[model samples]
Target: MAALTPDTVDIIDPDLYVRRGYPHDEWAVLRREAPIYRYERANTDPFWAITRHADIVNVSRQPELFHSIQRLFVTINEEGSPAPDEAILRQLLNMNPPEHGAYRAIVNRRFTPRGVQGLREQIDRITAEVLDGIVDRTECDFVTEVAARLPLAVIAEMFGIPRADWAMMFRLSNMMIGPGDAEYAGDETILETLQRARMEFFQYFSQLCEDRRQNPRDDLASVLANGLVNGAPLPIFELMSYFALLIIAGNETTRNATSGGLQAFIENPAQWARLKGDPSMAAGAAEEIVRWTSPVIQFTRKATADTNLCGVPIRAGDELALFYPSANRDEAVFDRPGVFDIGRNPNRHIAYGIGEHFCLGANLARLELQVMFRQLAERLESVESAGPLHRMRSNFVGGIKHMPIRYRMRPRA
Candidate 1:
């Protein structure tokens, strides 16, 4: 094959991905033309967009060769720069082997099946309360009223924070993830908004840390406040970074997944009927929803050394964009790739990513979704779209921002 150039390969566009209106059509063309494609834009680092499932697995499995410790996204600033701050760079998702292993080990216990299982009653009660508040309304913004608040409350409980702070945290998390979204725009640019959010998050967590240190509780924050990592209390910055990750990863991603799943169901009423007819299908439906939505659309990995991926040559400094959405829709992996079916067996999707960097909160997210869907199916007698849905303008972590839905409650059994 001829050496691939930027012109020949369809440069993966961040704006198109952000809009997420018709991404699969573009992805289909890219997958066939250039499975290992190079994307270059005006204000971002040039990267190889890995679109195939096999290639994504290959890249993720070899973390040393395809490092995640470097630039984590495709977009940059007005000056065309990559990630530049070391203090901000040392989080678990951005660290390599031995360090990543050690750091991940510290909190791995908290996210295990048993650990999450312990929170089942709390999660069920929380889900019930959320649904109770809105089940009677004829129409409501599902994003704000249900999807957004549920996960925020869950995380607040986990961190022992006030539920009233959800709105502020939600806004900060949006600014943190909304790369090019206009809602987060202000006199300060996107980068400034991100910086400000980080600072505010750090400050808030710092105060929480002080409280936890003085009067520890049973929550994760209390554990981190006094627990020893590498025989010393976790550093304040590192603790804060973990808190930030929990807020973004724990709160926003799940919220997006829930809302996006509901939107998917609304779009495909047959699938909704399948889920409603047999609530046993809730678990399978949840998987299908995540597969369809692919909430964390893409994550970045840096090349540690010269490598050849899917027969495409990559240099030492090259970056790889692991397109999770593309991988979930890979024809080689799933039959009738475009069809949305809750009955997909052996659905080994990379929505939660793979390897050591796999989302620690995956089990919690799964539990939350499963319970939410089950409850929604049981409580919602009839549900339909009341108006047009609005999606967040973000290339990464894409989902419906606003979904107006008219719903009626099912009579109590």
Candidate 2:
């Protein structure tokens, strides 16, 4: 590939993402030459690409300076503004400051280390069961079978959703998050698919909300339904967005991280050997996997006022794309950014992001990854790819749509 200039590189294009996994070559160029490169492309809204770790941290930390509400994300194909309904759906991801805190407080306790710790036995059971399904098989699609199962079951159980409805949650999340991929995009436009997904979730959750209200259960859905935000019930739209965000955020990121982490181990057998040798390294390995995968690819933040980032000028409304993957790989931060080291010490990758709007599900995600990988390390004897890897055609979420692997594992003990 020719050396890409800021004028030539189009990082937001989903097609480019599908053809080539991340544009690290392009990111490296920008990181070296222009850490805060202004990205301008036709049709798509122009924004500054913050590639370096320091700059990303600075921008992410100062949410007041760079607002999250102006625009929640960067779109690959921007035909026009966000749909009318999309504007009304407010969640922690798009909220800023006091409001973000208040909303997050609703379930914050439930996701803290202590809160998530309560689910350890549950997570372990789910992991063992998932691994058990693959123990007798010589080959399986790790993405769909192994990686996707734990998170889906865990989140559904938390919401008090029936086992039958878990598949709907999975389908809705895929359509909403991976609509750029042909597998889920179908005949509708991306925006259309997204809008339809929101409607379906609203319809489903609306009933769940009503049921939970009348017949309250000790579940997250009941909590949200009866919970108050600022001394009042959560508006229908916010309630729906909360459910959607949790289901997607909890499911998608962890699923991709597990699948991608396994791929990393396969390519770096030394790391795999080290992990298998010491299952205690599972916690550090989980952190490394999150850093390596950087599942939530990029989120857009607009400048609330005229402010400069890393010596780059910005107008009040100028948006900046915080490229998490690039930051995770910045040479300034990690000793060997490219190496997949499971036992990397002092790992401070901001895959969950930084500051005010950091992922609310961070603790839960960490717990899930740790349990899954630890179980695999102890039980999975040998593993290798069985077929080509198929990745989602999505630049937003770094997703592994399908990963076939032939592996040996000990049966549940």
Best by TM-score: 2
Alpha-carbon shift of residue 352 in model 1 (angstroms): 0.4
Q: What lDDT does candidate 1 reach at residue 91?
A: 74
What is the model-wide C-alpha lDDT for candidate 2? 0.87
Residue-level lDDT tens digits of model 1 in 1-413: 66544344333444665444546766776777788888776655678888889889888999889888544666544432224443442478788887788778777788898889988898889888888888667999999899987788888889898877777788888877774577774566666677788898888889988999999998988877776777887777778887888877788989988998888888899988888899889888888888888898788888889879877889998888888988999999999889889999989888999887888999899989998999898888888899987877666677567889998976434
Off by over 4 Å in 1: 1-14, 18-22, 76-89, 411-413
In model 1, which residue pairs have backbone atoms overlapping below 3 Å?
Answer: none
The 0-to-1 C-alpha lDDT of every candidate, in the order given, reads 0.80, 0.87
**lDDT of candidate 1?**
0.80
Query: What is the per-residue lDDT of model 2 for residues 351-391, given as tens digits with 9 covering 90 to 100?
Result: 99999988888999999999999999999999999998898
Count steric clashes of candidate 1. 0
Which residue pairs show backbone clashes in model 2?
none
Q: RMSD, each candidate, Å?
A: 3.0, 1.6
